[model samples]
Target: MKYTPHAYQRYAAQFILDHPAAAIFLDCGLGKTVITLTAIRELLHDSFAVRRVLIIAPLRVARDTWPSEIRKWDHLSDLTYAVAVGNTAKRLAALRQKAEITIINRENVDWLVKNNTFDFDMIIIDELSAFKSHRTRRFKALMKVRPMVSRIVGLTGTPSSNGLMDLWAEFRLLDMGKRLGRFLTHYRERYFLPDKRNAQMVFTYKPRPGAEEKIYEAIGDITISMKSGDYLELPKCLTNVVRVEMNERERRIYERLKKDMAAEIAGKEIDAMNAAALSGKLLQMAAGAVYDGEGQAVRLHDRKLDALEDLVESANGRPVLIAYWFRHDLERIRKRFPGARELRQEADIADWNAGKISIGLIHPASAGHGLNLQDGGSMLIWFSLTWSLELNQQTNARLWRQGQKHTVTIHYLVMKDSIDESVMAALSRKDKVQEALMAAVKAELGKE
Candidate 1:
C-alpha cells in the first residue's frame, strides 16, 4: 500500500498545490483522485494552510470512492473523512461529526451551502463537467458560497462534452468569473455567435473568430490539462460484439409485433406509443421481454439469456461485470445465473473488490462514475447498449482504468436489424462529435 505516483500524477499533484484556483482537465483512468488527495494531505500537514476540506462528487463516489482511496494508500491513510449523504437526518449527523474532510453528493450542494455556517478553506469539485449548465440550481447554490471558499479545484475528463459554451459556468466556479465572465449571457455574446440552425429546437453557439485560442490563453495559468495516452502505459482495450439470434418461433413473434405495431402477450394489449416507443419495444424484445402499458413486463423468448450463459461459461473463473438495461433483463439474468450479485449499494463494492463476487450486475447509469473496479475484472458485457456516450464510456472506464494488469475486453450484445444497431450508430456519431471538439480544444491549447 505504499504510494508511488506516475510522473503525470506527481505533476498533477504539484499543479493542484501551486495553483489555488485551477482545473485539472484529466482523462479517465488517470489518478486524479489520489493526486488531489495528496495535495490536500500536504496542505493540511505540511503547510498547515488548510483545515476543513470539502469534496463534491457523484453520489456513489462521495459515499465510497474518496474514503476508499484514502484507506487504500499508506501515506494518506491517516486523513479523516465523513460522508454527508442519505436522508436529512443522516446528512446532518454526518456534518456534525468531527472530520477534516467532508464529502457530499452534488445534489446536496445547495442544501449544505445554504444551511451550514462552516467556511471551508479548500473545496474540490470532482467531475466539474456536471455543472456545465449555467441554469442549474446546484451551480447557482455554489455561486453563493464562492466568496467564502479560499481555494478551489475542478476535475473532469470531458470538460466540453457538449461544446465550449459548457466551460463558462465551470471555469467561473474556479476563478470567480475572472477567466470566463461574471454572466453567461455576456460570455456567450462576447466569444460565441448565435446560430439560427434548428432555432426552435436547438440554438447552436458558434465560436467567435479566434475565440478558442483566446479562451485557452486566458485560462492557461490556472488550468493544467493532461491526456492519458501521453503519460500512462495504458493497457490495450479490445472490443467484441456478441450477436443474439432468434429461433424460428421467436423470429415470427418479433416480425409480427414489428409489422402490426401491437401484440397481445399475457392477456394484455401491448401497443407502441410512437415511433420511439415502437423502437423501445423492439429493443425490449431483443432483450427477451417487453413491458405493457399497465407497467407489466411480458415475458418473451430467452435468446439473450442463452448468450449470457455461454459468455459466463467461456470466461471460466474470471469476474465479469454485466450491464443490464431494464428491470426485467436483470430478473431474467439473475434467474439464469443464480449466483450473480446486484451492484446496488456501497457494501457490494467492497465485496466486488475483494473478488468475492464472480458475476456482478449493474446498470450503466449507476456505475458510470468514480467507482474503481479494475482490480476485480477486465471484461464488460453490455446486455443492452445505451444511447448516451458519456454513460457508455464512463462505465467501460471502471474496468479499463489504471491498475488493471490485463488487456480490457468489452463485449456488446447486439440483436441484428433492431434498435440495438440504431443505438450503436447514435453513439458513434456522438463520439465523433465529442472527439472533434476535444481535438479542436487541444489544438488551440498546443498553440500556447
Candidate 2:
C-alpha cells in the first residue's frame, strides 16, 4: 500500500530522527508503529546511522504485527526483519539470521540480555508503559545494557495510565535517568507526597503542587505527544451502559458474601480469604458466577448472560466483538452462543478482519495492545469489566481505530449495585489523570 504521511505523522517521524533517546506519547489509532518504522527506515537506509535495530513488544506483536507492518507498507518493503520469540533454540536461530531489525517479546528481554551479546545500535520499545515498573526483570535487564545502545525510542498511548509515577522507570530506560532521576526514591521524594500510608509503609503517593508540570517540562524536549482527535478524522464512538439488576435471592447472596466474605450459591461454598480475594469474588458474582473453595465456578445468576443475548440479537447479524475477563465467563459465553469464537491466533485475527466470524470473544489483557481489529466490526460488547485503564482503553481501540468506517458503538453490561459499578467508576477516574498527563505534554504540530 502507498503510504501518505499525515502532517503529524511526518512530525513524529522527524522527532525520532532528531532525538537519540525519544519518547512518543501517541494516542491509540495514531499509527505509532508505522511512524516509528518510517523513521527507522530512514535511519537504516537514508542516513546509514543504524546498522542493527531491536524492537521489544508484547508477544503477539513481536511475532505478527511488526513483520506484517513491514510487508504491508510499500515504503517499508526494503526493511528486513526477524522475530526472536518462542524457546531458546528458536530465538537463537532468529538472532543468527542477518536482518536490519530483530523483534523479541518483552518477557524474554532478561534472557536475551543475560545470555547474548547486546549489539543492537537502536532499540524501539513498542509499549513503553509495560516497563513502567523498575522492579520488573525486563526493565532491570534492559537498563543493564541501556548505555550501549546509541538510539532508543519509547512508544505508548497511555504513558501515565496509572499516574505520573510510571514515567520514572520509562524515562530512566530512555535517558538513563537524565530526566526523571537515577532512582525511584529520588523521583518520589522530589515530586510526590506519601498518600495512604501507615507507620510501616506507604501504599500510594500524590504529586506535590506543580509537580506534574515540572515533570512534563523536564521530559518535554525528549518527548512528543499527540491525540488522535487532534490529528485524525476518526469515526464517532458511542458508548452505552446496559444495566442489569439481580433478583431478591441473588441480592441476598451478594450481601452475604460481602458481609461474611463467604457465601453459598447453587450449593457451592464460596470463600474469600482477604480483601483482594473478596473483590475478585464479588466481581465474579456480579458476572453471574463465583469460584467456590475448591476453585469450581458456581453459577450465581444469568442476568449478564441474558443481557448479552439481547445485545447480540439486536445487532441483527452485524458482527459483535465480546470482551470477557474470567475463564468461567468464556465458558458460559461459549455455551450460551456456540457460534461465538475466541480470537486467539493470527489466523483468528485474519478471519475476524475478513468478517468471517459473526460473534467473537476476546480477553482484554491478551488482545489489548498491537492488534488492529478495526476492519472486523465497529460494535464491541464488554460482557465483563477490567479495572486497568490501560487495558480498557486498548481493548476498546481494537474496533474503534483509524480504519474503522462506522460510528463504533461500545456496550457495557454493568450489573447495578455491584462491583462492576466500582470498576467503571475507577476506570473513569484513572482516565482523567491520564488525560491530564497527556495534555501537559501534548504535541503542537503548528502549520505543518
Candidate 3:
C-alpha cells in the first residue's frame, strides 16, 4: 500500500515536478491516476503554493479513481478526498470543507462554475479528449475559470482523436491562449488542406516534416507523452481471425431482408445514399438477428456462438475477456457462454477478478475506459470490430497493462471479405492519421 512508484510513474512525477503546468499523455493503463496523485502530493509538500487539487473526469472514474488510488498508496492516506455525485448541496458543502483532493465529473463542471463554487489550486482533467469539442458548455465554462486556476494538467490516451483541433481546447485551458492560439478554425485553415471534396467539406491535414519536433519543443517541456508498449512488459498479443461463413439459412434470410429493404425504398431509389443503412440491416442479420415479421431481433446464425464456445473451451481455466459490439452479440455470447460474467454487473467483475468466474463479456464502449481488469484476465477475444481505433485500443488495454502478470493475447474473429476487413484497415490507419493531424497542428502553431 505504500507509495511504491513504478519507473514510468517516477518519470511522470519528475516531469510534473519540473513543469507544474503540464499534461500527461500516458496510455490508458499506464497508471496516470497514481502519477497525477503523486505529483499533486509532491507539489503540495514541496511548496505551500498548492492547497486543494481538483480532478475532473468521467462519472465512473470520478466516483472510483480518487478513493481507489488513495487506498492503493499508503503514503496518500493523509490526503482527504470527496466526490461530487449525490445531493448538490451536500457535495457543495463537502467541497467547501477542507479536503486535500476533490473529484467531480466533467458533466457537472459547468454547473459548479456557474454557481461560483470553491476555487482549486491544481486542476486535473482526466480523459481530456472529452472536452475536445470547443463549442460545448463544459469547454466554455472551463475557459472562463482558466485564468483563476494555478496549475492545469490534461490527461488523455487519445488527445487528438478527432484531429489537431482537439488540442486547441485542452491547450486553451492549460495556458489560456498562450499555446496553440485561440481559434480552431483559424488553426485548421493555416495548416490543413484547403479543398475538401466531400459534401460535408471536412478538411484533411498532412503533417509536414519536422512538425512533430516543433510541437514537442513548444510543449515538450510541459507535456509528458508515454505509450504503454514503451513501459509495460506485456505479453505477446496474437491476433487470430476466425472467419465464419454465413450458413445457407442465414444467408437466405439476409438476402430476403435486403430485398425487402430495397423494395421498401424502391420508389425513393435508395441506392448508395441509403447503402449504409441497408448494409447495417444486412450485418445485423448476418450476426444472428432475423427481422421475422416485426422489427424484433431473432437469432439465426449460431456460427458466431459456436466460435465463442470454442474460444471459451480453449481458455484453459484462464479468464477470457470477450468484446461484443451489438446487443444481439451480447445475448448470443451470454447464451452460449453460460456463467460468463458481464463487465457491467458489479458482482460479476469482482468475482471474475477474484478467480471465481471463468469468462467476462465486455462491450468496447462500456468497458473502454478507467476500469482495471488486467488483474483478472490477459486474454481478449473480439467477436466483432468497430471503426473506432480508440475503443479497440482501450478494450485491449483492459488486459495488456502495467499491473498484468501475463502476456496478453488478442484474438480477432474477423469475417473474411466482408466489411470486417475494411473496418480493420480503417482502424489500423486511424492512429497514424491522428498523429499526422497533431503534427499539422504543431506546424501551424510553429508558423505563428
Candidate 4:
C-alpha cells in the first residue's frame, strides 16, 4: 500500500533523522514503528550513514510488528531485515544473514552481546522502559558496548511510569550517562528523599521539591513526547468502578489476616510471611479466594465473581474482554463463564478479532505490549487490579487505541476496603508523576 504520513509522523521521522541520540515517548497507536522505520530507510539507503541497525523489542513485537511494518510500506521496500530470536542456532543463523537491519528480543541481549561481536552501528530500543533497572543483565550487557554504537534511539509510551528513578537508567542507555548521570546513587541523592525507610534500609523514595521540573529540563533537549489525544481523533473511553462489599464474616477474616498476618477460611489456614506476602494474600482474598500454606485456593466469598457475572450478562451478547492478574482468577472466571476464551496463541487472537469469541481473558503482563485487539471489542473488564501503571495503561490501550470503532469502556472490580483499593490508588499516583514528566517535554513540531 502507498504510505501517506501525517504531519506529526513526518516530524517524528525527521526528529530521528536529525538526532544521533534521542528518546521519543510516543503514546500507543501513534504509529511509532512506521516513524522509526521511515527514518531508518533514509539512513540506510539514502544517506549512507548507518550500515547496520539493531532493533531490540519485546518478543512478539520483534517477531511480528517490525517486519510487518517494513513489508506494509511501499517506501521501505528496499530494506532487508532478519529476526534474531528463538534458539541459539537460529539467532546465530539470522545474525549471519546479509541484512541491513536485525531484530532481536530483549531477553537475548545478554547472549547476543556476550557471544557475538557488537557490529551494529545504530541501535533502537523499541520499549526503552524495559531497561529502567540498571542492574538488569540486558542493561549491563548493552552498557558495555554503548560507546561502540554511533546512533541510538529509545522509544516508549511509559518512560517514567514508576517515577523519575526509572529515567536514570533509560537515559543512561541513550546518551551514555550524559543527561541523567553516570550512577544511580548520585541521581537519587540529587532528586529524591527516602519516603519509606527504617534506620538501616530505605524502601521507597519521593522526589524532592522542584526535582521533577529539574529532571525534566535535564532530559528535555534530546527527548520528545507526544500524546495520542493531541494527534488522533480517538473514540471515547469510559472508566467505571464496580465496588463490592463483603459480609460480616468475610470482613472479619480479612481483618484477621491484615492485623495478625494469618487467617482461616473454609477450614484452610492461610498465613503471610511478611508485609508483601500479606498484601498478596489480601488481594487474593478480595478477589474471593486466598491461597493457603499448601498453595491451595480457599474460597472467602463470591462477591467479585458475582459482580463479574453481572458484567458479563450485562454485555448481552456483545463480546467482553476481561483482564485478570492471578492464575486462580483465570480459573474461576473460566469456570463461571464456560464460553470465555483466553487470548493466548496467535489463533486465539485471530479468532477474537474476527468476532468468533464471545468473551476473552488476558493477563495484564502478557497483554502489556505490541498486541492489537481493537477489532475484537471495545469493552474491557479488570477482574483484578495491578500495581504497575505500565501494565494497566498498556492493557487498556490494547482495546482503547486507534482503529477501535466503538467507545471503549473499562470496568474495574474494586473491593470497598481491601488491597484492591490500595493498588488502584498507587497506579493513579504513579500515573500523575508520569504525566508530568511527559507534559514537561511534550513535542512541538515547528518550534525546534
Candidate 5:
C-alpha cells in the first residue's frame, strides 16, 4: 500500500530525520513505528546519510512488528531486515547477513554491544522507558557504545511513567545528557525533592515547583511530542462504567478480610501485610477470586463475570477484546465463554482482525505495545482494572486508534464498594500527570 501520512506524522518523520539524536514521544497507536521507519528509509535509501540501522525493541515487537511493517507498506517494503534474537548462533548469523535493518530485544542489548562485530550508523530504541533506570545492564552496555552511532532515536509514549525522575536516563541516551544534564544525580538535585527519606534511602521523590516546565524546555529541541487525538481523525469513543455488587456471602468474606487484615477462605489463611498487599487482596476479591500464600485461588462470586456476560452478549457478534489481570480470571472467563481465545499466536491476531473470533482475551501488559487490533473490533471490556495508567491507555489504544469503522465503546467492570473504586481513583490521579504530556488521556477521578 502507498503510504499517506497525517500532518503530524509528516512533521514527526521530518523532525527525526533532521536531528542526529532525537526522541519521538508519541502516544500509542499513533504510527510511531511507521514514522521512524520512514525517516530511517529516507536516510538509508534516499539521502545516503546512513547505512546499517539497529532497532532495539521489546522481544515480540522485534520478532514481529518491524518486519511486519516492512512487508505491509509499499515504500518501506523494499527495506531488508533481520531479527537478532534467540541463541548466540542465530544472533551471529543475523549480524552476518547484509540488511538495512536489524531488530533485537532490549534484554540482548548488552550481549550485542559486547560481542558486536559490526557497527550501525543509526540506532532506534522503541519504548525507551524500558531503559529509564541508569543502573540496568542494558543502559550501562548502551552507554559504552552510545558514541559510535551517528543517528539515534528514543521512542516511547510514556517516558516518565512514575515521575520526571525517570527521564534522566532516557534523554541521556539521546543527547549524551546535554538536555537532562550529564548525570541522574545532577538532574534530580536540580528539579526534585525527596518525598520520603531516611539516612540511606530516598523512598519517593517529588518534582520541584516549575520543574516540569523547565525539563520540557530543555528537551524542546530534540524531542518531538505528539498525541493520538491531535493527529488522527478517529471515531468517537464512549467509555462506560459497569459496577458490580457482591452478594451477602461475598460481602461478609470481603469485610472480614478488610477489617482484620486476614481471613480464612477455602480452608486457607489469607492475609495482607501492608496497604499495597491489602489493595491486592481487595482487587482479587472484586475479581471473583483470591489467591492464598501457597498460590491457590479461592473463587469468590460471579458478579464481575455476570457483568462481562452482559457486555459480550450485547456486542451482537462484534468482536470484543477482553483484558484480564490474573490467570484464575482467564480460566474462569474461558469456562464461562468457551469460545473466547487468549491472544497467543500470530494467527490469533489475524483471526481477530478478520472478525472470525467473537472475543479475544488479552492481558494488557502482554499486548499493550505495537500490536495492531484496531481492525478487530470497536469494543473492549476491562474485566479487571489496572492501577497503571500507561497499561490502561495503551491497551485501550489497541482498538481505539485510526482504523476502526465504529465508535469505540470501552466497558469497565468495577465491583462497587470495593477496592475497585479506590483503584480507579488512584489510576485517575496518575493519569492526570501523564495527560499533560499526551493529549487524549483525560483523568476522571471520582466518576465511579
Candidate 6:
C-alpha cells in the first residue's frame, strides 16, 4: 500500500512535530488514528526522543484499532505492535517483549502499573474524556506513572462537555497537575462557585468576561484542535422527525397501567421520588415494553418498527445506517431489516466503508469512536433517542465524514409528547445546560 497523506493528515503530522507535549482534539471519523500513527512513525523514523509508544484506549478500540491502523498505512507497516487482551500471564509475556508499539485498554492501565509492568517512552491516551473524573482510581494510577513517560498526548472530541472541571483531570494526566492546578477544589474556586443549594460546583463566566477564551487559549498552547467540518466536504445532514401514533392496544395498556399505578399511590402525595419512578415505567412502555398486571413485559406498540420500515422504504435503495439504543430496539431492527448487517460482526471497519455491506445497524455507544464508516452509507435513522450528546454526535459522524460524496440525512423517529422528545431535547442541549448552570451559579454569587 502506497502511503498518501490527506491534507488534514499532513497538518496533523506537522502539529505533532511542533508540539511534543500537546493534545489532539480531533473529531471522530476524521482519521485521528491515522494522523496519530503517522506522527508515531515520524517520531520513530526521525529518531525523536520517543522510541516505544503506549496507546491507552477503550476495550473494543484497544482490541481492534491500534493493530488495524498499523496495518492500514504502509509507513506504519514496519512498526511492531502488540495488543494487551488476554490472560494476565500472557499479557505480561507480551509486555516483556520488545514491541515498538503497545496498545492497552484504559481499564487495565491501573492493573498494569500496579503490577510493575514495563513502561514506554511515549503514552497516547485515546478518548481522553474517559479520564475526566479525577476521583477514579485509574486516573490516580495514570498520574503516578506520568513522570516516567517522555511524551504524553491526550485525544478526545469532548474534552469539557460537563464543565471546565473535566479539563482538570485530563490536563493533570498530561503534565502532572500544572495547568488546572493540583486539586479540583482549587480549580473550582478560581473559575467557579460552590452551589450550596444544589450541592454542586458550577463554572462562572460572562459573555465578555474573557475567562473561557483565556482558558481555551491556554490549553491551545499545548493542544491542536481539529474539526472534521474544517477539512471534509461532508454531506448535508437532513434530519427528519417521524412521529408514530400508538395503536389502540398500546394506548389501552398504557392508560390501564397509569390508572393502576395512580390508584396504588392515590392521595398519597405525588413527589419527585414517585414521579421519577412513574416516568421510568412510562418510558419503558413508550419503547414498546409495557409491563402487564403480572409485572411481565407485554408487547405494546410497534409504531417504532413501522417508523423504521417507512425510513428504509424512503431510502430508495441507498445504504442506510441505523442507530439503535436498547436491546429491544436492536431486536426490532433486526427483525424488520433482516438484510441489514452490523458493524461488530467483522473486525474491519473499512469493509463497511468499502461498500461491502448495506444497512448497518450500530449501537451508538459501541460504534461512536475511532472507526471510519463514511463510505458505507449517507443516511442515518435513530431508532430511539438517548440523553448523550457525545454518543449522538459520534454516531452521526460515522456517515457524515470526509469521504462521503452524497448528502447525509439523519432521521429521528420520535413519538410526540413521549420520552423520545424529552431525551432528544436533553441530548441537543446537554452542553448548554452545563454552561447555563455554571452561569447561574456565577449570577447568584454576583448578587451576593
What are the models' TM-scores?
0.83, 0.97, 0.84, 0.97, 0.91, 0.82
Error of 2 at 367 (Å): 0.8
Query: Tens digit of lDDT per residue, candidate 2, span 1-448?
Result: 9999889999999999999999999988888999999999999999999999999999998998889889999999999998999999999999999699999999999999999988899999999999999999999999999988999999999898888899999999999999889999999999999999889799999999999889989999999889888887888999999999999999999999999998888787888999899999999999999878887888989999999999999999999999999999999999999999999998999999999999999999899998889999999999988888899999999988889999999999999999999999988888888888888787888634
Q: Each candidate: what lDDT?
A: 0.84, 0.93, 0.72, 0.93, 0.86, 0.72
**Could you tell which candidate, 2 or 5, scores higher by TM-score?**
2
- Show model 5 residue runs off by greater than 4 Å: 196-201, 255-261, 273-278, 439-448
TM-score of 2: 0.97
Candidate 2 regions exceeding 4 Å error are: none
lDDT of 6 by residue, 1-448 (tens): 6778776667766777677676777766667788888888878777666888989998778888778878877778888888877679877777877688988888888888898655687999998888988889889888888888878788877766655657778888887767767787776667664443433544343222445655665565677665656565566878788888776655665665565653222222221225556666666666665443444444566787887887888878877888877676677678777887878845446667777766888988888876567777788998777666777877887777777788888988887667777877766566674344223222111110
- Superposed on all Cα atoms, the candidates' RMSDs to the truth, in angstroms, are 4.1, 1.4, 5.3, 1.6, 4.4, 6.9
lDDT of 1 by residue, 171-262 (tens): 98999899888998899888998775564654577889988778877777787777666666779999998888887776777787889888
State model 6's lDDT.
Answer: 0.72
Clashing pairs in 4: none
**Candidate 5 C-alpha lDDT tens digits along 1-95:** 89998767777899888899987888777788898999999999899999999999988789899888889889987799989999999988999
lDDT of 4 by residue, 1-448 (tens): 7999999989999999999999999999999999999999999999998999999999988998899999998999989999999999999999999589999999999999999988999999999999999989999999999999999999999998898899999999999889789999999999999999889799999999999999999999899999999888899999999999999999999999999999888788999999889888999999988789988888888899999999988999899999998888899998999999999888999999999999999998877899999999999999988888998999999998999999999999999988898899899999999999999999986431
lDDT of 3 by residue, 51-109 (tens): 88888887777877667887788777777888876568966876776688888888898
Give the best candidate by TM-score.
4
Candidate 4 TM-score versus the reference: 0.97
Decoy 3 TM-score against native:
0.84
* Clashes found in each candidate (C-alpha, N, C closer than 3 A): 0, 0, 2, 0, 0, 0
